[model samples]
Target: MAGLHLAQLNIGRLRYEVGDPRMAEFIDNLAFVNDLAERSPGFVWRYEDDSGSAIETRPFASDPRMAINLSVWDSVEALERFVWQTVHKRFYGRRHEWFERMDERYFVMWWVPAEHRPTVQEAVERLRHLRQHGPSDHAFGWESLPAAQLWKSARCA
Candidate 1:
């Protein structure tokens, strides 16, 4: 558990295009939320492109409107604090206004080596695994195992 980190991937399908007026607020706040994540305690890394955010990256081939966010945190608590206890929470509250409500699971979390930077392919596979197998050490949803057990069980697998 000494060198383990938490890697998380969350995807959402936008109800409108990034430049659409309907999504103006969400688009406007992307950088602020990303900045908050970078400044949060226990923040490690986030996937970004030349524009400094991954909002425009199309990792999911099947859906062009799907936006992917991948990042690593020192612990589950650190990620939680950034997600639920910051300005990002306001955006989260209004997600339904900008993004479609997905029926399938749109996010996954897993343990990775401290230095490992997860790729989009890896995140996609984890999401697929979670969808197909429910919550396991390899890939899980929000109601995941404790970090200690998750690392141990993932190692054993």
Candidate 2:
């Protein structure tokens, strides 16, 4: 059988103020959304820790605003639709209202085969790749998704 790979999506948010009310609402709903996605179409596996809760500042976790979650899915389209075409879309639209208004530096998507849930360290590297290179065969985003099918990452980004 073909090897399995799971596409991983990672995102982060910078906080101007930590205890803002809107920030609370964003956090609340973000968890709910992740919960919903875990059960939705093409869902396979996701990061054990919620992306919204984890933050660190170091070479690997250099961005204080950065957070992480990764999942293994059956197909890239399955993952993309779940991100842009669902309640998750609302979160995407309102990032500016809640977080810093930076051009898409905080979120990134890339492919891995099944059974491979990436760690925070791996997720950070993938985000770096997408920033260094636009969407390509190795690193990509939702807009650059391949045709409808599964993917197996010979190597993780």
lDDT of 1 at 84: 68
Q: Which has the greatest TM-score?
A: 1
lDDT per prediction? Answer: 0.84, 0.62
Question: Candidate 1, TM-score vs. the true structure?
Answer: 0.90
Give a tens-digit lDDT track for model 2, residues 1-157: 1565556756646564445675777766766887888888888877664244343323244465555556777776676667666887777667667666556655566656556677767777777777888777666765565463322221122
Distance from true location, Cα of 98 in model 1, Å? 0.6
What TM-score does each of the candidates earn?
0.90, 0.73
> What's the TM for model 2?
0.73
RMSD of each: 5.6, 6.0
